[model samples]
Target: MKRSLQITLLVVVAALGLAAGLAWQAWRDQPATVPDATGTPGSDARSTITSLVVGKRRPDYQLPDLEGQARSAAAYDGKVVMVNFWATWCPPCVREMPALEELYETYRDRGLVVVGIALDNGEAVVDFVDPMGIEYPILIGEDDGIDISRDYGNRLGVLPYTVIIGRDGIIRHAHPGEIDLEQARAYVEPLL
Candidate 1:
């Protein structure tokens, strides 16, 4: 009886240790949270964003711009639109602002419309724009930001989410985090 009990204890300990090891390995393999458009880190900072696949109509919805003017997805019809969801607090988002602005300027004449959706409600966005020389339209999203993001397939509500809508109104690609300029340029130039 004593020998049997000792063997069972050993097995239980070994099983627990194995379980812990597996958990650790899984955690280590997880991706880091991406910062929002600005330099501020958010609670969902460590999540990974995936690209939107082809063959889907771009999610359409109406949102208010910074001045509270109603804007709809249809406003950019017949043109290639880049919709970027960002916050002034996200570091990565801020880091890529200049690049995005430059990309917009380079393609605006070719029917490229870059719209920035600010996820934060505070005055941070208002302050960040001027210094960054952001020429595109910036809109406030408030609490409805998450809902708007979900409509664009960003279920995790990650900042710096970008979706490219082709001229035909099809969603060409949706990036959940920061925009890759090279990839963005490649996708937009062809659509132009």
Candidate 2:
């Protein structure tokens, strides 16, 4: 009887340990809170990070250009504007910069304006732009930058969020990752 009781107690302990382990594993699988496209607290779950509609109306905020002049969304009105939020450390952001510059060069004459909002320090951006020869304007942003991003529908602070606004000042598309040139062209062509 004593041996049987000991075995039963061991089994109960083992069951509890197994249950705890499973619970921990389940918790580990859950997504952690990170910056949303807008730089606000958000989750990384793909289901929650899909395309978010930002709608019309430009967000009002002041950010300095490389030359220290104040720039705002109003600066690019009546043009097809592509506002891209990126950081220096993001590999995808680096990869997309050349394409973005090419796109800007190709379409700038045709009324396309591209703006990059650097969600990092101004000095880092300075370092990034000089070597890459980025022709489009890049604005240095802070926490409030997320607010502008949110206004354009980027709730998850994911690097490389692009908002394309039409000539009417209405937001036409919001992409959360690296944008393909063809796909971007398709979205902007209608507005042009």
What TM-score, computed on C-alpha atoms, does each candidate reach? 0.71, 0.74
Structure candidate 2, residue pairs in collision: 35-157, 36-155, 36-156, 36-157, 37-155, 37-156, 37-157, 38-154
* After superposition, candidate 1 runs with Cα above 4 Å error: 1-53
Candidate 1 residue-wise lDDT, 61-164, digit = tens: 77787667888889999999998888878886887788788999999999999988888883766776767778987777777766777777776667777878
Off by over 4 Å in 2: 1-54
What TM value does model 1 have?
0.71
- Scored by lDDT, the top model is 2
Query: Could you tally the backbone clashes for each prediction?
Result: 14, 8
> Cα miss at 102, model 2 (Å)?
0.9
* Candidate No. with top TM-score: 2
